[model samples]
Target: MTTLTLRGLRTASRFQRVQPHPLLGLQSQFLVPQTPSFRYASTTSALPTRTPRTFPVNGPSTTLPAPLNVPARGENQSLVPYLYSVGKSYLAFYKTGVWNIYTNFKLSREVQRKIDAQNASTFSAAVVSASLTRSDLQLLVRNWHDIKRVPMFALVLLICGEFTPLVVIAISSIVPWTCRIPKQVESDRRKLEQRRSASFRELTTEPPTEAGVEKLAKTQLMHINKSLGLSFGMWDWVGGLPTGILRRKVSRRVEYLELDDGLIRKAGGIQHMELEEVKMALVERGVDVLSKGEAQLKGHLNAWLLSREKAPVEKLLLTRPSVWPVRMNAPEKV
Candidate 1:
């Protein structure tokens, strides 16, 4: 039994020696050596380094295109003349007020009704007068009540009304020297004038080429159309009386010339047509022919131009069949 046990033990020891312990072999392969002979070097230090890179930024361009137009000084003239205009308008209003009073006294239905009512009440005239006085007192009380309800608002309005005239006078006196045209407005006005002047120069100096004529005509037409759009009537003038009059007389005149340029372009070249032929041509193109003859054409044309210039493009495009490119391209006349 001892011999068999010894043989088994020896056999086990020989098997263990042949296998050489799998875990011990793995640890020997993987475990880091702590010996000084096994020093580590950094992988990053052996690799080449790169310089820091930068990109350039873009900036706004300094050079700008020159302005196309410059407005005349006359176009942006001082407000001093406007002050005089205001004074004239005030006088006109005062006169109109007096006329209104006279008209009311003579023609008002309310006034007539009052007179009839008083006449009908002849027997109780004294009582009626006393009642009227009492009613006026009541009206005053009601108004006082209203004023007291919004005391702050009433005070502001009273102060404004009391001081308005004095303020206006002060402003007008100071405005002439102190107030200049705003830079933006002045710049815009100058640009407009420059454009108009350029157009005028082209019309006068350049030979009657179709392109030149067409360009001028279009420019003028646009101006005239704009002016007509902005046109105001008598009511607008009357409404604006309390403020500086909002008349566009100067602008209208400029636009009128523009309209004339368009008309002239339509009637062949300026050099091609006689004055009479031009008038006839204008009449043909919806301009009202004055019965008073050629002498009155200017005044008539001005009025007619205002009416004609309104929705000029729409009228041309919609009503005039021959003016259309499709019609123009047709073999037969439209």
Candidate 2:
């Protein structure tokens, strides 16, 4: 077993002694200790300050915590360095993903389900316990999605050769999350904005009344489903979405939004939200923020939060309630 001690891993030959990874630094807190003995002292700093962790790797079979997602390469960076840097990052990201899945493969369905349920806790508790931010978990899942697209990337590299970047630029959606250029992100956002623009119009039509269900319930529901990027199962274009499926999908989406709202609030509310986060939240709510400045985005998000956080219950209703207002599936707040 190779044990890596974070505090004093100055040198290692063939990983024979404790050492920092070539790619990962000593300060990387993304990989939490698997052993119960090495628990987080605080979410702000997941690793214990005084004690050193012994990160054991049992060949390639070992599963460590997932790596941090590759952050977007800076805009000023030339294309060559951008490609080179992300290539290394993706290699590390992919290896850890395979190892992670391999370790999980041994679990029984019940155990797996329980683990998953535990993982689905409100961010207030989960951020401290799991040592992973909500975005980290999302990126971790996205990495798995990218794993399946390996063949597609390999094919492009083979056929296009030196022109692979051009091919990738053309088909940017298929590019891995870690490897997406700024152009691709803008392209993807523009596409999502189109759908969100339509859905946002429908979602905000009636202003989430407390008295009863809004008008044109089915049409609004379809738009809600579209905004969430939900799968339209058991419905045809002629019949539109079935009421049963529509209610379930919208409810599930609200539940997820509830979780996200708590996470953002816990992360110190809209004022503390970074520029990228502000953009993302606005876009999700169906605002076109392509040309908006950071200050303007925050103002919009603040307004969104006030309306969303205060009246979550009314927004959750899918049908005319016998009662005046519906109960919200509230997430635990910090």
Candidate 3:
């Protein structure tokens, strides 16, 4: 019986080594299934588990997201909404009279300064001499049309109390205060138009000779120089107040020296002179002309005429070489 038991124990050990235990197989089937072997990789290390990321409460990521697909303020959108917003805000502050008070103070100070400057005498003397004559009154009447529309009540107040100097000053200070920025913008536009018109007229005038063309070129160069030197003045700063916060548009006007076909024809055709002759003339006048294609020769010449060089003229003259080959005399007949 002992020998038989020993043989049975050895057989059982062998059987355990060859096959998985019944309990392990049942657990695997119920809980975890056996994975199939892959031809490339049968075993792989398990990946690390990822933890949830945390961010600071006060960081920009926590802020409200920007409005996507919304058009920019100036991109052909109606301004009714913006105006309504401004009106709403203004109404909130209407009871404060802050704008009116500030305007009145500024105007009073400005008017006083003007009064003092014009008279250069005692305050009483200035007031006494500042009488509105019949012509002055008529001129004011004519100029009334120039002023922008004001409230009917404001107009009545201005007209009824025209005799009273204090009332006149008050009305003048308040009535046009709101329209000042628009008036200034209009004035600046007019000035720019005038300048452009004058330049155009000057350029259109026919120059008699090449020298005249050179003179015009110099004038244009000078104008460019002046424009480069220009900066935003006090008036520009004041006018910018109305729209500066709403938009960052700059009001600078850039003028270019553009010659029309008529003007070009008047100033002698580009092919009137030989390239060598033109180049020589420009060099003599201390103008640097870089040799380019014949197509760009006209532009170079125009630039040469317009350059404002302070250098003294050089005496260099360019001449084309003779194209004819050396002539050989016929061999003497013997």
Candidate 4:
């Protein structure tokens, strides 16, 4: 047995010498130092990265141009479609000029109604005179002559400034006499004038009270705003206008040689006037000084003026009504 064991050990030793030990078999390839396969294993450092690009979104997703209804540029575009584009919107139109016909016509009607209702017995003489160009008046005279006024009645009118002859003749000839002034149009012309003068006294001559002026201002502002496409708490039109006639179209008492440049410049550039300022100017210009709310309006106005230290009004006061007719005390007295 000892001989057999010795022979086996010698055989194993020969086998080990021929090959490597089993424990080193796995690392045998490493001992040979085989080159790394570039195909399977990359040694290059990782790249600094970013997300991949994406395509832009498709149709109608684009933003719309401002003042949407404005005509798109090009030959095919619609003609200056809205007042907004031209900045001729209702508020700008009416608050500025004859636009009141478009904007404040209803309000004027309401105010007139209120006046008529309040002064049912008063005779109102609204003497609105339009200066006629010589050529136009001549044309009108020619037209009148062609209409065949009775010679006697025309003579009477020319001599006495008597409209009665014209009225009577027109009443007789008219298909319906719709345009003729009403005969016996009950009026207290003197009384209304007195009242108007009184109202003015109550407002201007007296110490300030907010009742008259404020009411006038508020009502006028409300109407003007509504006419111009705005209202209380609504100033949306300030930014721009939408499609349509921006203001009610009306014939203006005032004349202008041109629409875009002539009168607009004289009235103060539309761009230069803010909406509130426009309202104030309109009320100040159009309204009669004797309206009922003038006292109240004058009060606030006086306060504002006094606050601003406007000229001619050294100081203002709001004395109680018991002072019989209201009066203003000097600032020193106050």
lDDT for each residue of candidate 3 in 30-117, tens digit (9 for 90 to 100): 0122221111011123221122211111111101111112223566657986555444333322211222222222222233344446
Candidate with the greatest TM-score versus the true structure:
2
lDDT of 4 by residue, 1-334 (tens): 0111111111112222333223222221111232111110111222211122111110000010011121235566465554233333212211121211111122222223433444441212110111111112112222222223234433443453423323444333311111122221112222333433433444433333332222223223223223322322223336223212212111111111111112223333333333322223223222222333433433332333233223111112122212323232221110
lDDT against true structure, model 3 = 0.27
- The lDDT of each candidate is 0.28, 0.45, 0.27, 0.24
lDDT of 1 by residue, 1-334 (tens): 0111111111122222333223222121101221101101111242212222111010000000111222233566687765555444433322222222222122222222342355442212412343222111112222222223233333432454423223434222221111111232234334433433443343322222232212333334433322232222233334322211112322333333343334333333233333343343343233333334544444333333333344333233112223322222211110
Residue 64, model 3: lDDT of 12
TM-scores, all models, native as reference:
0.16, 0.50, 0.17, 0.16
Order of candidate numbers by lDDT, starting with the best: 2, 1, 3, 4
Write down the RMSD of all candidates, one decimal each.
Answer: 45.8, 13.1, 39.5, 42.1
All candidates in order of TM-score, best leading? 2, 3, 4, 1
- Regions more than 4 Å wrong, model 1: 1-222, 225-294, 297-334
lDDT for 297 (candidate 2)? 66
* Shift of residue 57 alpha carbon in model 3, Å: 50
